[model samples]
Target: MKTVLLLVTLGGLLVLSLVGGLFVWWGMGGVDISLHGMIALTLGCLLSLLLGGGLMFLVFYSSRKGHDDEHHRGPEI
Candidate 1:
């Protein structure tokens, strides 16, 4: 069940990304912007993933670093 859910979630994201790409392609056709559209779309998706992943990493890293710092503090006399 968990695997099925994961697959469905990933599939939904792929479909949405493709739909976004199509919108960009059609919306900017007047200026021969297909290449630009694709680049922009790819960058946008990459940025989104990077930002989201970075935030998650930052949270966990800060928490774990603080944890280790406290653990390493000298024992009270």
Candidate 2:
């Protein structure tokens, strides 16, 4: 039952993403993109992915190593 539900959910998401992508592509038919623009867009996406993945990895790694433990603070005057 769980497997069937998971499969159905995934299938629905796949269909939705395909339809959304098609609509977006059709809507951008009038836009003219240069080679440099395409290169910049690709590099931006790659760098953003790398930065986000690095931050997430650091968070998970610190958490697993107990670096996120609470610290005792002295009373303020």
Candidate 3:
């Protein structure tokens, strides 16, 4: 059941992305990306993914290590 739902959702998103990209390409009317531009875009996407994943990892790590827990060592005097 869960697997079926996941597949359906992913399928819908894939279709939407393809359709949107097709429209964008048609609208651009053959505007081409230079090699440098393509490299920059790829690097930007990779950096964004790495930064987001690293931040999420730190959040989970801190939660598991109790760094985000409330302190109960008595209120400061």
What TM-score do all the candidates reach, one by one? 0.46, 0.65, 0.67
Between candidates 1 and 2, the one scoring higher on TM-score is: 2
Model 1 steric clash pairs? none
Candidate 1's C-alpha runs over 4 A off are 34-48, 64-77
Q: Put down candidate 2 lDDT per residue, 1-77, tens digits, no spaces.
A: 99999999999999999999879978998988899998998899899999999999999998888777644345669
**lDDT accuracy of residue 24 in candidate 3:** 88
Taking the tens digit of each residue's C-alpha lDDT, what string does model 1 give over 1-77?
A: 99999999999999999999789868886756488897997899899999999999987997877975786689889
C-alpha-based local distance difference test score of model 3 = 0.91
RMSD of 2: 4.2
Q: After superposition, how far is residue 62 of candidate 1 from its true place, in Å?
A: 3.2
Candidate 3 clashing pairs?
none
Candidate scoring better on lDDT of 1 and 3: 3
Tell me the alpha-carbon RMSD of every candidate: 5.3, 4.2, 3.2
Sliding window of 10 residues with minimal summed lDDT for model 3: 67-76
Clashes of 2: 0
